[model samples]
Target: MIPSYLKDIGKEIHSNKESTKLKIICTCGCDEFKLFRKKKSREYIKLEKEYEEQFIKEFGRGFEMQSDLNGQVFVIKRNIFGKIVKKTEIKKLDIPLFKNFISVKCSSCCREYILFDENIHGYDAVIEKNQESTIVESKHYSDDSQKIEVIVYYNDDNEEENINDLSVAFGRIKIIKITNNKKITYCDFECE
Candidate 1:
């Protein structure tokens, strides 16, 4: 008869599988949401590369998307030799039913909106701080499968400024932008 310890080990293995539940991977045209597979770990990178290759072999090419900052819906086009073959717009609302998305908060007002999910996990900026003026342009993803940008202006007359993600209610961002335009513009994500 199998020993009790061996039986316990088997049970543990079974439970481990159950605990690490594998959901149906989200996709559009075979390889949507591929970036989600990437993590800041070597192991994850290797595994993702393997998965990507396997997917390419099985499902063919993936979509190349282009969208504006804070705009929902992405344009997917398949190009050969840099010529557009076919193009279509995929809206965030069009994400398949199986996957889940979270609602994001406005970075400025800290108010909430039920319009979309928080697929964009981080913010980035393009900033230029010179003796004349300080201009910043922050970018982020939206639940609408769109990349959005925001502009922040600071007074160069001040000794210095620290408008980091940690300093503002926006928290941490994945990207930021800085522009030299004197006329300041606001982030479109800000609610009225």
Candidate 2:
């Protein structure tokens, strides 16, 4: 469960507003935390980076918890909110890092989350993967229908590739390699 102050932070993220304080409440009753983000005018980049590192260190590296484009992010966890709220003040609650950091629930919330199921290593691979994204054809809207926008991941190298050919046809394509146990994970899309 998100506290009032923290919920405001979420709202701020959605609105892209500048906020100074953030309050977060874990529904699991494990720990309630409050975060005070510096003003955008100040040097927030460093603070945000620190937050990411600390978050990963506390939560572990097993799952990706970042928020996605649509902001549909969540991780299931058992909560005992009854005991936690009883001991704290509802209006003025202050605590440190959330209890037992789980996984990220949003990307905008964190920005370091890996939302894709596969690990993309190049642009060609990204084009191939994003090709599967549902295509919304614009009818009677405009004639610029030859172009398509796709979301994908690529490595530091070979990040630029052509997107035109990938969406031209839809079959099955592997965009990149996924890593497991420090090894690459390969994916094959099979069309029925």
Candidate 3:
């Protein structure tokens, strides 16, 4: 069972200002999390690169994660000579690389955690309510054959900026992954 501290208020990932709508209660029962923003700011860029490395290591050799035009993940396969052979996109989180992810330290454990789905290799997002992420698009490089996945919500908000703006308004978000095979797990409060 999911602990009471980790219940989802169900707000979608709509904005940066109302992060609490996600209602991420620290396991330590304290409210002293350091929220990180999504942007090219010095801190965010540095953190993003590190986060990228972590994903690469987690996904391993046969699978690689790269960003598509929408800033989501695309996987690629490499041959023995490290030559690119195939690339595929993932139908997962919108901000592929921990965009709105934050680092929070539990007052009780003093352990910092980054919310992540151990199975999905991503976060639990309220993407269903996103007004700006409606599209079904894919890209293919002229060389080195590959395929990708698209998880389009088909909303009217085609504008990323407009969607970002809506994020600040309202939504419910959660951090759990379940499969039809009956696999279910709460997102890991990864200690950093």
Candidate 4:
């Protein structure tokens, strides 16, 4: 979930003419929406640092925790006290990476739309703009050379005046790369 203040800003953006062209219409036929950039708060960043410090203090320098895009955190533990450090255990932690998303809320029915999320390793995003449209593309690549792309199309003038607005509206955007064998594509559009 994003901060309420950001949602308030979204409501303000929703009132803009350019925003009307960029909003995703709700199933209820409402085109007005509150847009929010999902980002990590300062407190969250500080806590994350503290957690990393504590994790290193408890498990030593070589041990580390891994987090997936779905917000699952896990650590591998070995039986260090035993004579043989062969047995290992996998433990899940409650910490979640809640950042890196774009959320939109319908002004009428209050429905929420979460976009551009992936649960794979090596995730990236790219934003491309021509005179007529802006395309936000997200890519996920696997070690096996498989890549999946999700592209969101925004039809607008892409002018300087609306650049800041669009940046704030879309939050953190990312990019993609083509792999050896397989490619998959998915698209979503928001236009007047």
Candidate 5:
């Protein structure tokens, strides 16, 4: 069950017009979802302070810096001279990203989904009945601003499938050839 405070925050996130434009439906055919957004609220600030205090209590020293990398938390213990004394990697911290993003879970199926990510150029998901799978595709921009497409396959049961089972190849444009005066386009991608 979601807490009432979190539900209030979800309502605040849903009030954004741009966020509402992106629709993500669950495989169970339910469009309702619980939204969560990272924002700077009084509660958020309190949570951060509490975490820092807890870290100091456990480590017996105040951490100079804290970071979350690849779902792992790391705290840097610095000496009074501002030199790094020790760097310790700890368990995952529940701190959210400072950037703009919207996370959601299906109300009916409880399937987790990302509605929007600031780093991603585009995000979408759709169910392919013929293939008996749900196709999720996200577009990302490289350092040079080149568009890259990332695709994830999920079965009808809402479980993620292995990437090796994918039948279609991605990250390439369709090749067109003329055979006997007939145009033939190879490498057709349904989720363009």
Candidate 6:
């Protein structure tokens, strides 16, 4: 859980109108889950609730949550861009359906979006458990100022180890961005 002090700061940030926007992940690919292993409506609903609670505890309140568009658009209050950047990096992540357009939305008036899920989760899990990693550019933003960066986290400690089963454990990330014009842009990592 985020510390209380940080939540207070997040509240203050959300109150500001001129805050920059950030989208951690966004997807544009096909995976096995989309073609097979379909989940029931109730299962999707439960997943949405679980993700919402986790998002709220990790992020904060005043954010929007929904399960429309295949669990897309988990909107959060604006002004949490910095926090998103710092926390978006997965330590031991796992998910099985992130490569199927499950985007997250940010209601900062600027409309930020992110694509994250099983693929990303699997990537992080593999990297944490194995040793090989791959970084690739997945998608770029329509905005000239923003670019989408997708990194595949993996680890192949044993050359004979097969990652086929890990499709449900680790994968890729699609980042949607909304740049802050006022902030000085530095490296590729600098979003604003």
lDDT-best of 3 and 5: 5
Tens-digit lDDT string for candidate 1 (1-192): 111211211112111211211111112211011111111347656766776686466435765666668764554545567775655565444222111122223333333222111232112121222122111133233432222222212222222435332112222212112234232221223210
Candidate 4's C-alpha runs over 4 A off are: 1-23, 47-98, 118-192
Please report the TM-score between candidate 2 and the true structure. Answer: 0.18
Query: In candidate 6, what are the lDDT values of residues 44-75, reduced to their tens digit?
Result: 66886787789778767654434455644444
* Shift of residue 106 alpha carbon in model 1, Å: 33
Name the regions of candidate 1 deviating beyond 4 angstroms: 1-62, 67-74, 94-192
Q: Could you tally the backbone clashes for each prediction?
A: 17, 10, 13, 5, 0, 17
Residue pairs with backbone overlap in model 2: 1-27, 6-23, 28-79, 65-104, 66-106, 66-107, 67-106, 67-107, 125-175, 178-185
lDDT tens per residue, model 5, 83-109: 777788876569963334445566567
Estimate, for each residue in 1-192, the C-alpha lDDT of model 2 and write its tens digit.
Answer: 111213322221121121121122233322212111112323455665675686455544453333447765542222255222212112322322111111122212221111122223123335555433322232122211111111221222221444433222222322222123232222333221
Give the distance in Å from residue 152's predicted Cα in candidate 6 to where it truly belongs. 2.3
Cα-based TM-score, every candidate: 0.20, 0.18, 0.22, 0.27, 0.25, 0.22
lDDT of 6 at 91: 33
For residues 54-149, what per-residue lDDT tens digits would candidate 3 score against the true structure?
Answer: 767655645766886879777776778988777766785434443333233443455544443222221223333322321213212122111111
Worst 10 residues of 2 by lDDT: 142-151
TM-score, candidate number 5:
0.25
Q: Write the per-residue lDDT of candidate 4 for residues 56-172, one digit (tens) a residue.
A: 766767875556687666565567563333323446556774424444556667666553332211112113222222122532222232222222223344343334234323322
lDDT of every model, 2 decimals: 0.28, 0.27, 0.37, 0.40, 0.39, 0.33
Candidate 6's C-alpha runs over 4 A off are 1-43, 46-146, 163-178, 181-192
What is candidate 3's CA lDDT for residue 49?
A: 72
Indicate the residue-level lDDT of 102 in model 1: 25
